[model samples]
Target: MVEKESSRHPEVALSLPFTGLWLARNSPARRVPSHGTDLFGERYAIDFVGVDERRRTAGHRDWRTFLATEPADRFFAYGRPILAPADGTVVEVHDGEIDHAGRRSQLALVPYMLGQAARVRQGVRAVAGNYLVIALPGGAFVALVHLRAGSVRVSPGEVVTAGQHVAACGNSGNSTQPHLHMQVMETRDFSVARGVPMAFRHFRERPRGARQFHTREYGVPAEGAVVEPLPLPGAHSTS
Candidate 1:
């Protein structure tokens, strides 16, 4: 427990939660106050979606996948363990949302986009899906959102070390595909918590179509950039 509440927020850089080519979208560094709905609270949230060599978010598609949405299992990110971005205590967990089907077609996306308002009014479960809140050091809180159903590995109050496997990425809540929606905040209650700017400790980034990734010590991944975490000297990706 902290002895005295510190007013000055420290510059806390975290580990990128997963491995491989994850494309960042709606990153705060690229655009201030990222999404429209983000104006509510997730003003600085970043959405990470894994992509393959061809830059496709999913694999081969068939008629079944086109007419009806495909299962989350088809996406590259599905079932990948989401690592803890920093050492922290599990402050909140909500894992009841069913992993929704993946959608890449513009036809399916239209209806889903129209329903955003309803999900907003329905509450956090509808929007954040199966998510967890980590109360990190220096009084910063992080919300890892849209996890797969039943993939959470820790319970509330449990202490988690940085890079520990916490949950698997999924297309739950208001998500259309398997991806991780991460954001930092001042408090554990994200609904009322103000967004806190966050950066990664050490990672490699390459924009789409780039030949090489430039290594960065401590910085935020730019929007549309593909990133991967640089494993610590003796440690590697958990799963």
Candidate 2:
């Protein structure tokens, strides 16, 4: 598959959502944790949870547990920068809630496991964890979920450019680990919002278990696929 090209503002592009180590790309075969129900009446699909390749060796025993506590001096661990996918205004920002502990520990897992449903039914504040929704100029809204509490840098009605940092990734809401859950939707209300399949422009996609990175103008990583943002010039450009 090919990536769609971004002709404008090719450089000065936003840094990737994470730094340091690489990560698994999008693919259906991968088995990451997922929230929300699926098309076949399944309650979930494998979503991007746990640590990406960059944070894999932080010495935490379990991925879910690491998100709950303060780890090494990495801000992105709980507060990675969540950049705007496209220029837009802050239609919504959800914050002010504490993150839950990782589920790897028996102590942490026991309580969370029991109260999972109760927390979910509480609504967006409870289920989305900390989140931000931006309205793109083109009539699409982007939802960035699992953001750290008190880390949202943008506010409602604020206008932001594409690739601008808005918030950091976090383990909150229904998340079992530290990872960013991004999706495009047509509506502002997540309760009624249906996910729109999205593809990235000029992003580098290296298939999981593959040795080389394939440059694309635009493409969608499969459910379990791993990807990294590539530098420009060598990175493909949009037409």
- Per-model TM against the reference: 0.91, 0.71
Instruction: For each candidate in the order shown, give its overall lDDT on alpha carbons.
Output: 0.83, 0.57
Model 1's C-alpha root-mean-square deviation from the true structure amounts to: 3.7
Report lDDT (Cα) of residue 182, candidate 2.
Answer: 67
Per-prediction backbone clash count? 0, 24
lDDT of 2 by residue, 138-204 (tens): 5656777778888888889999776567787777787655667666565678777644445566666
Which candidate should be chosen as best, given lDDT against the real structure?
A: 1
- All-Cα superposition RMSD per candidate: 3.7, 7.1
Model 2: residues with Cα > 4 Å off, grouped in runs? 1-57, 62-76, 105-111, 231-239
